[model samples]
Target: MTVGQRSGPPIPLLGVEEEFLVVDTDRGEVVPEAATVVGRARPALGTRVGGEITKLQVETRTDPCQGVDDLHGQLVEGRAAVQAAALSAGLRVIASGSPVLGRAVPPPITEGPRQDRGTATFRGLHDELAICAVHVHVEQPDRDRAVLIGNHLRQHLPALLALTANSPYWPERDTGYASWRSVTWGRWPVAGPPPFLTSARKYDEHVDMLLDAGALVDQGTIFWDLRLSTNHPTLEVRVADVPLTAAESAALAALVRALVVVAGDAVDGGDEGPELVPELLRLAYWRAARDGMGGHGVDVTTGRLLPAAALAERLVALARPALDEAGDGERVEAWLGWLAADGDGATRQRAAAALRGRLTDVVDEIVAQTAPNVPMSEESTLA
Candidate 1:
């Protein structure tokens, strides 16, 4: 189970946490059924399956994995477990960033004092809080080094976001943007890319400032796209939307871990990394959210537009060394080839909607793709 720091070579270990939307197949929409699904899944998955901020969402976490193959198996198994639990309740799970179909109202938040406080403070913002994401945790024992590594990550966040843009719809219609989830998530006061921090001291200072100003509920409220994990000895990247399939999620995790390794190396060599203009970084994220891999993205370095796919390829090149170090180079390259041909989740979702001419078809596609190996009865697919 222990992944990082082995004798042969110190390959950085990584873990993935993926969130899913609980959907009612008959209604073809997300439903407030996470508690029920989690209850059923817990007996089988133990700590691996759990509820999230909204009752319509469930999440799975993998133990630290030494390589992508182990991580992919866990991701697939987690999806299968959640699917089994949802089917028991006549519900299905979809991996879309946003619900393809929903009622006019927001799904209810899970009841708790912490959840209640968030609801009270954020108010209407919580109405669209049913989005899900894929969070990758890479081993980083030194907090100061992790903070510096975050700076190295900021430039690449947009490319990462574009490749995993699964939420092209909201409620009942296409949102035009690929990752509506990113746009929706950025509404929070403390969300988006972390700012440049010189050291762990600066990182704590920033968190303390937010807490003192009530901009955050607690340290847990620091929802930066990348940050030093409060509960794990890892640097967490929360930038990607929940990918359409577990394979994509695993591939995304491998790329993230590679990038983190690259960043950590740069940090150790005393590379200050680029202190990008904050506006540029924000603009870059917006471009990725809007386009995914189907359009152009902003290159922070040159301040010029490039195809998002090109940017993503460049990112793979940047992480190639680290990828090879962990024996993931070929796997990551294969994923890139798959993405180039089949397109990202956003593209696939839109394609399904176009071909089937119904939002329900989009839901069905997500469900089937999420756990293709699991057999679903007629009732599980939308009629």
Candidate 2:
């Protein structure tokens, strides 16, 4: 069935989880100070601020929001809180997917049984796992519907990844992919594109199979590009990098919510979900990572190549009805227009590097884009 064939119900309530890399403000190197930052941020943000798997990453979540405008403001506030907290420690929070320059030695992991076990099991796999991502959660009543929506959402993941591709550098050199984080993440046992599924039962069955094979330590380790949340009644899209700024992150979240809405409408219309070759879907992910928004992308419908920007346009068109209905049509379009003219995080990072001939400049660019003009509240400011 063609995408955007029909309008969906009112936009589902959505929320965003944005992860950030903590870095030394002056030297621009990733720092293992997430605990300090999260500790400081929690006084104001409460449960909204948390530590990630690594000590260098901090994550922020906005409460479920009804509209893009509210979500955007929350995102900005969350970023500012983290920025302020990090600043208090002589550190900064940057939104790059991978650090421009990491320590010569491996970074420290957060101490937890699950995290420790994973560290023991994966060993060096977690070395480059300092990567960050922007996860968008759209509310669903149950896991079954969420799984069905995921099937419909799977085909669009690559395009979404292209639009939010922000990780272009790894350590000291460019990885030559728009999202090196996605590439590094694919090395996980349960990562990358998920199997074509028909129901929540199938999803559970697949999880059991992975568990039996020792591929996953627990159900929570199912790191598909999309999945049903273990702790919430939402379908989580974990494909995109942590965008360069709150505005871009908000726009990407809006698009994701629209996509989920459109997919749900199709399911209600009796569409079983489109099934594509698993190998081709993997290739599509690779293309999206390699080219991002500035190069060619795979047309998931036909398994053929299309320009990345055109694919993005096609995705926007597919979600137009939902966007218009949700009152986010203009804002999203304007953001897309800006993305086209200025490029995505990868493009901007490359431009910064070229202009200054230093990776530190790229970090500075990210720090500036993250939340430049927004005034921090007195509560969030450093003492």
Candidate 3:
């Protein structure tokens, strides 16, 4: 069945999909626990968390909401539920894009058709690639806007990467990249920024051409950096890696919402900020993937190279108007400042690892930093 066009008012909404690793706390190894975790959280099953390829990973999605405040609450509740359930099942939830201590072992595919297809397809593509990510979806008024935002947002993707750079250590060693997960994920055939689709009709035509050529089974296979969701009325931005904490996740979501509102307003005003050719965008993405925040940057429109931090500053300046328009300027600035000060997740993780000399210690720090507070029950009595 063909996916229908997006239907909604111009009011922006936010949804977050966070992929987490199931870790054995004692050994610091990846373990397959989809059945155990999903079984235990049956009541909250499908409502908050769901299974992903390889039982080692699980993903939780927040219900769609109109504002960041509500979105934050959903994230907190969902994360709390998942953490409690995971702890109960002898597993711990980790927020890194790729776990540092896990060995690559293919886990059984839990019963489902789409998941089965995904597992088979990925296994055929590459081995030793079990990474997780956080995908953010924002509701678009229509498909044309979705396509436009998808293209324009490509320029700002690096800045987002700099902010959400988790997963420095990979496979028990320092990958020497801020977000190795980004590199690992790029192995997929259709991953990365998509070719510009100017309108809904153009996007549909591209999908049709791919299907006609037997390139894909359906829209589900088109894993662009940003794309219209196959089953939802939202544009999915799969750029940022999963962060280590719910606050970080919410911060990333807030940035995404701000971008959509900014881009949507620009489109509505007939101001297409600047033209970015495909090659230039690719180079920028490559640099971001390579050096992350420490890498060179590319001009969004002209493709001229610049320092990554300078480009990030320019992006923040460009986004200021939109943040102000959305009345979220303070929050956005604070979030960006945190990233700048801490130097993204990759840098911080490396620092922790270097200081502590243990990858598990780094993971423990991430968990402690990101986990939500558990309130004490009022009726509890001391033994």
Candidate 4:
């Protein structure tokens, strides 16, 4: 393929999995209507739609696409289908870090003996989990490459979290953290940054340990923020919240695919990914979770703190070559600028709530932004 036409890593296809909360539009409260919404969406979405652990949320994933533009289209289609299906059920689908205007009570559990077992095992832990996120899956050349990509991805994953932070309000008040979902996910037994490991075998051993110790209910519960896809030949990035707009979601998916390409290239060139201390990684995660793109970010490379805008630009610079290979360098930069100026979903939510003096206004704004995206910034393109 020509330089301008080449896609990422020999046409490595990527897909997006997004989770959304089903809310009663009138009352602006999360409703346990996921099963019904997923059912209503079934004829169009088929198995693409699934219920989460709780019935207040539904998950939708796009089919793998080789092009970034194609991935964006797939994401938009998925969101539109979800919105239409949800509207038919007298509800609206809101894609936020957490459902802002509702209590934390567990909704109905999704039907399945396995799901039942999970709830039965974890009880309150599983029951209280209702956060939604957008997971990007980038095709891996093999298991070994997947592990290395996960390691390489570790340094940059917090930047991903910073850009997509959407859950600012939850648990009955403003949490003051950007991606409260990250905080909530940290409560899980096996979640957050991956440990330093060079090979896929070691990765498997770690997962096996978690399963044996019952820290994980099964392979699906591995929950390593970023992980090797258990079923597909892809490295899955699970750090981002379910963004409020199709554009934000598309921006994140493109960056993830670019990072996957960059990481794969590093592995091919026999480069070892960085080995930062887990404590540093934890602090970085905490900083990003607290501030989103509105505050300083921990520079994982040098341990120096940088403004979120500079850090975001550094990430784009690091991934520029891969982004060029994927034909999305310009698109990513444009959207990155937008995210910097506009702030993440969490910032937007807080602003809306502050203006309208009600959390329900924030919910309404989220639902509207989910469709026909309200531009986050006037400066969409960056030089």
Ranking, TM-score, top scorer first: 1, 2, 4, 3
Q: Which ten residues in a row have the lowest lDDT in candidate 1?
A: 1-10
State the lDDT of candidate 1 residue by residue for 1-383, as single tens digits.
Answer: 33344333266788999999998979778889999999999988899999999998999999888778999999999999999988888899989888889862577888999988888778898899889999999988888888888999999999999999999998998889999999998999889998888999999999999989888877998899998999999999999999988888888898998888787777778896789988888899999999998899999887899998889889999998878777778888887887889888999999998986988889899999998888998767687
- lDDT by residue for model 4 over 1-383, one digit each (tens)? 12244433474778899999988766678888888889888888888888888888989888888777777887787777888888777778888889786665665677889887787677777755889989998878588878987788899888889988999977558988999889988988888988878899999999999888888778888888899888888889999999998877887888888887778888888876888877778888999999998999888877789998788888889888878776888888888777767777898998888885887778778877886532222221111
Model 2, residue 29: what's the lDDT? 85
- As for candidate 3, its clashing pairs are none
**Candidate 4: 10-residue stretch with minimal lDDT:** 374-383
TM-score of model 1 relative to the true fold? 0.97
Alpha-carbon RMSD, each predicted model: 1.8, 4.0, 5.3, 5.0
- Sorting all predicted structures by lDDT, with the top scorer first, yields 1, 2, 4, 3
Model 4 per-residue lDDT at 153? 88
Note the Cα lDDT for every prediction shown. 0.88, 0.86, 0.72, 0.82
Best by lDDT: 1
- The TM-score obtained by model 2 is 0.94
TM-score of each candidate structure, all chains considered together:
0.97, 0.94, 0.88, 0.93
Best by TM-score: 1
- lDDT of prediction 4: 0.82
